[model samples]
Every structure is written in C-alpha cells, then in structure tokens.
Target: MRVLAIIVLALIGSAGAEAREAQEGRADLKHEILKRLHDPNAARRRDALLMLGTFTDVPLSPILHSATDDPDPGVRAAAIMALGHASHASNAQELIPTLLRALKDSHPLVRRAAAGVLGRVRDPRAVRALQEAARDRDAAVRAAAVEALGEQGDQAALTTLLERLRDKDPFVRRQAARAIGRLRAPTALAALLERLVREEDVDVKRAIAWALGEIGNPHAAETLRTLSRSTDPYLSATAREALKRLISDATARSRRR
Candidate 1:
C-alpha cells in the first residue's frame, strides 16, 4: 500500500502546471514597480527592486532603506545597487553610508555587489569602509574594494593599500598594486620596490614595476635597475622603461629644488 501511495504522489507531481506557473511567473513578471515596492511576498519584493533599478519610474528612497535590511540577502544586494542606479548627484551623500553597510553583509554576493556600487559613489566618507573591505574573505569583494580605493585617490589610503600588496590571492595583490600606482605617492616607492624583489607572481611584479615609475622617486631607481636585469624579458623591459622615467623625473625634481 505504501509503495502504491508513493507512486501515485510521484505521478501527481509530474503534472506540469505548477512547474510552468513558477517559470512563467518569473519570466512574465511585469508588476507595477512602485505598487509592489513593499509587497509582503519575497518574490514580489525582489522583482520590485529589479524593476526599480532597471526602470527610471521609481524614485523611492524609503523603499530602498527597507529593502537594504530585508531578511533576504539577495533582496538587500539588489536594494544597494538600486540606490545608486536611481540616485543622482544630490542623493549621493545619503546613499554612500548605506552602501558601505552592505559591504559587511553576511552574504558574499551582497558584499561584492556593495563594493562595486561604492566605487562609483565618489564619496570621501567611503574610503575607510573600502579599506576595511580589502580584507574581505571573497576575492571579488577584495578586488572591488581595492579598485574603489583607487577611485578615492586619497594619499591617506597608502598604508592600507601597502598591506594588501601581500594578499594571499595574487589577483587581490595585483589590484592593490595597481591602485597604489594610481595614487602616485612617493612614500609607496619603498613598498613597491620591495614587492618587485619579493613577489613571485609575474603580473604582480609587473604592476609593482609600473607603480615604482608612477611614484617617480630616486629611491626606486636602483630597484628598477636591479629588476631590469631579471631573466623574465617582460619584467626586464618594463624595468628598463620605468628606470628611464624615474631618472628623468628625479633629474627634473632636482633641477626645481
């Protein structure tokens, strides 16, 4: 009897309408974006957020805040991006902090998405949060944070950026080294030089060589000279070019002094 009941249940579930409704509802979803902004159903709320971000009809900041704290992480991630996608310059001040909070979400995707949105914010207040997120467990989030720090372009971030140069993930290290290059801080010369000597990752070595040239300090000249002798042709060529620029820049600075 039990075997017969199980067979009957399997046949009933095989009928297609329920499966079709779920798939079709997701595909044909065109709910009134604003009316469903605070809908009780999780699916409706998520759909509303997607619409609010993709469409320009909604300018709902209150709905954005509620979504930011939604029990569903996917909903919260969408809400964070929606704030930036819909907001103009006037609302950047309010949106930056919320975006920073999203970086600390338990969900890796949320943190990664928040990191990307924060980079576009251009708010100085976001620098500290971006720096902290450079240590995020997710490589994508760490890379995004490094890129965001570059967007800030503040010399104050130099120390934090130097620390990331040693990140276990070569991608994160490369991104950090690239951001350091964008800063053009002379103080970064020592760190960049050390990384050039110690870093085994070829891409990271190349980025360090570029950052040394960008920093343009005479202190980096000898490091560049040493790297120019490397067996790796690419590193040798980059080092030669960087040495020329650093020497030229140092000569120019000495003339001015």
Candidate 2:
C-alpha cells in the first residue's frame, strides 16, 4: 500500500507540473503571437496565424476571418487552417458554414486546409460538402476530402471511400483504404483484400496492410501470410507484423469467448 501511495503521489506531482508547463507555454506563445500580429510585416503576421493554429490557440475573431483574404496566398491558407482548428477547439458550430464555404475557395490550398478542419469537426453538416470536395480537380484536395470523410466516422462515407480506392491518384487511394479501416466494418474487408492484390504501390499496400490489421479479421491472415513472403523487404516485413497482430487478436477474442 505504501508503494501504491508513493506511485499515486508521483503521478499527481507529474500532472501538476505538466499543467503548469502548459499554462506557461500558452502565455509565452500568446505573447509571441501578439508581437507578430502587430508587426508591420505580413510574413510575421502569417507566422502568428500559424502558431494560432495550434492546440493552445485562441480564435482572434473577425481578424482570422479577414486574414482569410490576405494578399499572400500562404497567409490566407494558414488563416483558413487556423479558423478550422479554432472552431474545433472552441466547439463553434457556427464556424461550420464558413468552413464548408471554404471548401469551395478559389485556391485549392485553401480548400485543402478547410477540408482538414471540417474533418476535425466531424459534424454531419460538413459530410456532403466534403464528399463533393473529394471530387475536386486537385489531387491534394481530393486526398484531403477523403481524409476528412474518414475522420467524420459516418457510415455514409463507406461508399465514397470504396469508390475512391480506384482513384487515379495513389495518395487518395491510400487515404481511402485507411478510412475504410477506420470504419471497422466487416464488409470493407473483402474490398480491401481485392485492392491489396491489384495494388502496385508499396505505400498503398502498406496502408492496406495496416487497415487489415485495424479490421482485425482473421480472414485476412492467409493473404497476409502470402504477402509476408514477398521479395520486397518493406512489404514483407509489414505483412509479417500485421499477420502476427491478427493472430494474437484472434487468439485474444477466442479466449474471451
């Protein structure tokens, strides 16, 4: 009991120290942000906006809104990202409509940044808009939209993700595979297996392998074992690791039953 009490006391002290450090860190960051915000240089202000996109960020209303129209493309992109982070941080559902509108921003970078924020929101309001943005002309924007759809945790995204697996851009296909894993639906496993066989990109194959591990279905064990023997060292190593994970997970489940 003394040892347990000592451990508890240590944890309490550690937590208190962490809290104090966080408070101090936020104060320092805010001061720097303010200094940069008031600077005559647009680059400095952009730097401020970038910091404001972080976890300790406080939304500088109307300012952040106006920053979205800054003359510099980089500043505008950073501002859009900051707004989304701020909205998610503050639970400002009112910001949803603004973020959704940003998905159509003239700049694909702005649209990409906005898609990221909406994904964090995970609000149903952003789902349809994200789906449309998934078809954006820019591959990066499409990848971003697919990523957001995955984070939203909506079952409706399952069909969208399935279709995106065949996207011309390999990045989008990988993101789709990762999202399908996030859904954890058994039905997605077969599609993943089919894609895994035809997928030539090592990165996409790795993503699929990790997704299969996330699904934790023993049915993938045989396929994983075959991939584990492939000539590609990275792919073979990852597949072997995933195979072990599947077997251990299956064993745990069976024991519980």
Candidate 3:
C-alpha cells in the first residue's frame, strides 16, 4: 500500500537524520529532509516526522497535516509533536483537524501528544476537546489535557478546571491547580483561596497560594496579608511574600491609573 511505503520511508529518513543531525552529510541533505515526511518506512517515517519538526516546519505544513492522520500510532504521535514546533499560524491551522482527531485515538500516547500540541496551537475549538480530555481515564492523559486547557487560557474552561481541583487523584488535583495558576481566572480566586485555607497537603496548599498571587486580586491581597500574620510559618511566609508582590503590583497599577 502507498501509505505503508510512506511510513517505511519516513522511518528510514528519520533514522538517517538522527544519525546525521550533527554530521556534515545529513546537515547538507536538505532535500532528503523534505523527502522523509512522506517516507513509507514506519521507522523512517518516525525519524522524518521528528526531523521535519526541526527542519522545514512552515514549508512542510501540508505534510504535517497528512502525518497527523497516519495509520501508525508512532507516526501519528511524532507528527502531532512536530506540529507543536511549527511557528507559522497557517501551518499550525492545517494540523488542527488532525490534532482534534488524535484526541480520540485509541492509543493513549496519541491522545497525550495531541493534547499537548493542541495547547501549542491555541485554537478556540480545542477548548472543548481539552476539557473532555481533562476527564480521561488515564492520569497522564488527564493531566496533559488539563495542562493544554490551561495553556489556551480560555475562560470557557474555567469551571471545568475548578472542578478538577477536587479530582480524587492528588496528581490530577495538583496539575489542575497548577493549570489554574496558568489561567489566573478571577472566578477561580474564591476556590483557590479556600483551598489555601483548608488544604492539608503542603504541595496543594503551596499551589493554591501561588495561584492566588497569580490572579492578583486585591481580595486575595487582603487574605494573603491576613495569612502572613498566622502562626504556621510556611503559610505565613508564603502569604507574606505573595502579599508583598501583590502590594507592589497594586502600587504599579495605581501609579499607571
């Protein structure tokens, strides 16, 4: 099959590129780099997919688009990963449909890679997909999806993330909290501040404190200032530092106003 051949060639090319990445022979084989994206060898295909990500990104848009749908999971994962490295908006757009499809791939790695790449693409349509992924059965996939949603920084997914902060798994809760920090939603302030006050887990509490500081609300500023005066040294120290940053930020805003 032509698809099989493409996969093979791609694998071989990828291997060759890996071998030649720092070598003079492969460095000059620019033409071969373009050929690898369509290589039929699955192994070669994987190599080419990786190289294309580092090589001809903008010009290889059409190829990256096609690579995302490769029948081989390895190829699909590599292509999706490569798409994340593409700097051109147009090139990134062409891969969106494929990345979206990867979200549902039977292969967990494909789903994970797709989730991460979607974050890099920053398309609004990906918000829903990432939200769905946040609930995936696999912890790694769920975390990746949560991270992707945070990367998009879309307000639409804020409620979903807020709910995730209570995920049964501590890893998921930690990631959700970290992602909330990335999102810095004002609506998230109440929950994060509450978590800061109530969470017994040191790491989660630290994340909550950081999230409040990131949101930069004066409401949080007041609470953090209050926490600074508490007997628990760690919480007090974190709250005090956060309060300082918030105060400095507020002063800057006031001067600008």
* Top of the candidates by lDDT: 2
* Cα-based TM-score, every candidate: 0.69, 0.81, 0.74
- The positional error of residue 118 in candidate 2, measured at the CA in angstroms, is 1.1
- Write model 1 residue lDDT over 85-114, tens digit each, in one string: 878777778887688778889998789878
lDDT of 2 by residue, 5-35 (tens): 9999999999999999999988987878867
Arrange candidates by lDDT, descending: 2, 1, 3
The better-scoring model by TM-score among 1 and 3 is 3
22-113 in candidate 3: lDDT tens per residue?
56664566568767756678889888778777874247667777887788889888888877876466656766777788899999889999
Clashes (backbone N, CA, C under 3 Å), per candidate, total 0, 0, 21
How does residue 195 of candidate 3 score in lDDT?
A: 65
Worst 10 residues of 1 by lDDT: 26-35
Q: How accurate locally, in lDDT, is each candidate? A: 0.82, 0.84, 0.80
Model 3 TM-score on a 0 to 1 scale: 0.74
Off by over 4 Å in 2: 1-42, 54-59, 88-90
